[model samples]
Target: MRLYFFSGLTTSCNTLKFDSLKLHNETSNHVTSNNITDESYWYYKNSVDGLWRRWDISVNSETNVAAWKMKWLNQEPKNILGVIVYLTSVRELPQLNISLLSLRQNLFKPRPIVIFHEGDFNNVNVQLALATTLGTNIPISFEHIRFPTKISIKSKIGDLRLGYNHMCKFFAIMLPYHPLISSTFTFYLRLDYHSYLLGPPLTYDLFDHMQINQFQYAFLMVSTDELKFVRELWVLFQEFLNDSCIKPSSAVKKTQITAATGLYSQAVVFNNFEVSNGSLWRNEPRIHAWLRKVDNAQGIYMYRWGDAPIRTLAVTQFLDDNQVVKFRDIGYFHRREYTCSSRMHSCSIPSYHRLASHIVYREGCHP
Candidate 1:
């Protein structure tokens, strides 16, 4: 799957490593040959002797002077992950140091590591001229959120090409009786909004741009340039409350998700095929199995889908709760909320995405 992170180093991502089990983008430097098993390429294995590794990259016409290069040499835990920067000028290298060393963090979580950019760096004089000329836009990206803390995310709200920054409400397709007392339609709308932002910019000739205008207004109270537009948009949307956002007494709208832990020892097939954690043997082999693979969790969404038969996450991160501070950064998003009632015990909030979709939740059947 393919996804675009709204935040993170501006560089396109390629791999998600975990002890010999690696995922690398097809176009990345380390994955070009398409011979993942060849194991004899230049970019094959730079990581430790055992820990999983994957490297990725592709060609682009992005930089010339003061550019940045990533040399993640798979060194010791915290030995060598530094930016080899090409700045426009050394006159203010000290200022750029903040951008240079932001990646050198000591946090237990993976904070957003990055390098700021400007003009030519190799030449001290040119570097200074470029920095001053493009001072305002130098940082490239900023964070309304932090990372590697209680939160598991990092991102850069780059130019519009990254994705649209807007608000979307999550609607309870099942619960229409009490709209306000259910999971806010925020998440569902968000995926649509992502389609907008990540798709491409719209070009209109004004007179016939009424549709665009209404669309923009629906997302933001007032619109200006991209940056200011999102600020206004955020406030306008937050007011509408949902069962998850504001916990209050109200006519219940939707089912809740209950968390149960245990073990599974058997399997049953709709037809004659087996579906286990390891085999994602396309839904047709059996039936729909998309949502089934997503472990239940709040604030979840899918990021990428592509030719590799694997997944590539572009922007798979969401705010944790009210603060909009801590968030869960993942390739796809899902959440499970426990609901208690007058039943024998408790049940989890139920959600269905396309009908007849294969339903697979972690549990053991009663003997």
Candidate 2:
């Protein structure tokens, strides 16, 4: 089975460092028998041949595409489940390409990757170049989803003006339904372009655990008490639910939103669940309308309204907190912040040595 790995990045010297990690590792076009050991992690295969499969089916005739999908479906693995969904804007395409290159060299198996972007057809060509240059064997596809530059959500902090980065990240929630994304993929992994997987190849068994629990989303749990980010998130989330005609969870209703800065007070984390998709239809339109309403509104524009809180809240609307697991063992690193331990060290690439030092010596809030 050949799985395609996709990325959302571009070709630039400034961002070439991101793909430098690929240089340290060998690039193989096929997985030999020796490489497929008991511990080897395998990804879904793409029986549908050709680079044309990389583009969204919406661009082609629906009847023709449907016939192709039906044929592909027959060859899909029985255990074929989810995909790693990566998002990036046109400008960040170069960086994402670097990430994909590194992923190609590091992992034991290739993953079915969908690069959900906020760009035009030209950007898709750039991604294709990077994928080919990286010499990845997996099937890769790109989907261009329009993101709003302006939004209407009222923020207590100040005027909220979201950029491409913010919109692309949050827009991932809808990628599972995109025409380019196959229904065979039940879970979608939303990772940052800068986030590098250093160690412990994620096995399919772990995905089975995730799928069994009905988790639609997952994230690395970070401290939000200091900034009162989660509290504000709850208040805003409640308003979002009300506007969307969905009911807010009890954890959201009972939580108190206080104006407290960094102090000794411990924050409340909402760990609550029931599985429901009643509000899925309101996902895109509500966010779009709200952004349009607030994009040009007058207020302070010093600080930006981040997507983390909103994204976290969005997952809650679909699944309970128990379904959204926080995995620290993934050995993730974004910038200087990382999850580095003795176990992770064994499987990590050479770059971990330099990056690990910065994390251990530097004083930064790593959540």
Candidate 3:
């Protein structure tokens, strides 16, 4: 397996001490020889040294910025398919600007951007103009998705009307039912309007790995010990999957993830395998109809279920951990929490990315 690192950094962001990993497209100082690693790499290792300690980037005598661009940024991968975002409120416009700008300036090649928002296109256009000024040149299309007026979630607190942001998660899942995506497609990367790409744009190779592994979904796994709601959310997630007629798979069990402790947070990548043909996400009417029932059903609000953990649980029903990959090097920050190692940050160019601090509740993930 080849170990790919991100580049472009002036210094370490936050406490991340290492800075040699940054991939600078303009300078060859970060470029290393292709005579790197030839061994298979497993993402999850229980070593205190962290994967960064083992990363070996050999310095070469001469720099080839053009070749470096060709290898990492010049060509776009076909497997990316498309990128989607669900923006529910106008308040998110500011965050949208930052996210889109980072994407436009950093993404290797332009990919289709589909924005689903309830706000008027006028404001969206304004934001787009700002993003363009920031560097967005990719083709973007927008669709108006109405926010659900009522919440079926019956809470002991009262008739719960989960905010529009929470509702956005449901709309996000509606992708499999959409006309453009097909059962045989490769993969589609989904991002919340607030989530931005901080490393080199993802490529077809990662998607191909997911396809070969038969992964239906991929997400960033959160340490259950760090989240208070993991147990309750997992219980409700299991209930939803059970009601939806999803089956448990051993792959999920291999990770020692229980109904009470599994959690995959932030950016989701859906593969065409089970997601396209299986009963879970692929079952549009059946699952959505079931969701309506659950939404209205009472007693579930005790856990205050969230879409991130819920979707993570749902995927476990049909696929195993083997099919899924929890990325730590992508260098992402939600509100503030950073998942990448110091070496990973070394790859990030600060002008194009921000250092993440402690992770906070994503817009709709918490009360």
Best by TM-score: 3
Give lDDT tens digits, candidate 2, residues 110-164.
Answer: 5556665544423535756755744646556655434433444455654454553
Global CA lDDT of candidate 2, please? 0.40
Which candidate, 1 or 2, would have the higher lDDT against the true structure? 2
Clashes of 1: 60
Tens-digit per-residue lDDT, 33-53, candidate 3: 322232321011111211211
- The TM-score between candidate 1 and the true structure equals 0.18
| Candidate 3 accuracy as TM-score | 0.55
What local distance difference test score does each model get?
A: 0.18, 0.40, 0.40
lDDT measured at residue 322 in model 2 versus the true structure, 0 to 100 = 51
Query: Could you give candidate 1's per-residue lDDT for residues 197-310 as a string of tens digits?
Result: 100112321112212222110110000122322222222112212211432111111101112422111111110000011111111111111111221211221221110111
Q: Any runs in candidate 3 off by more than 4 Å, and if so which?
A: 1-80, 127-137, 151-153, 157-161, 168-175, 180-186, 200-214, 225-248, 251-280, 283-303, 341-367
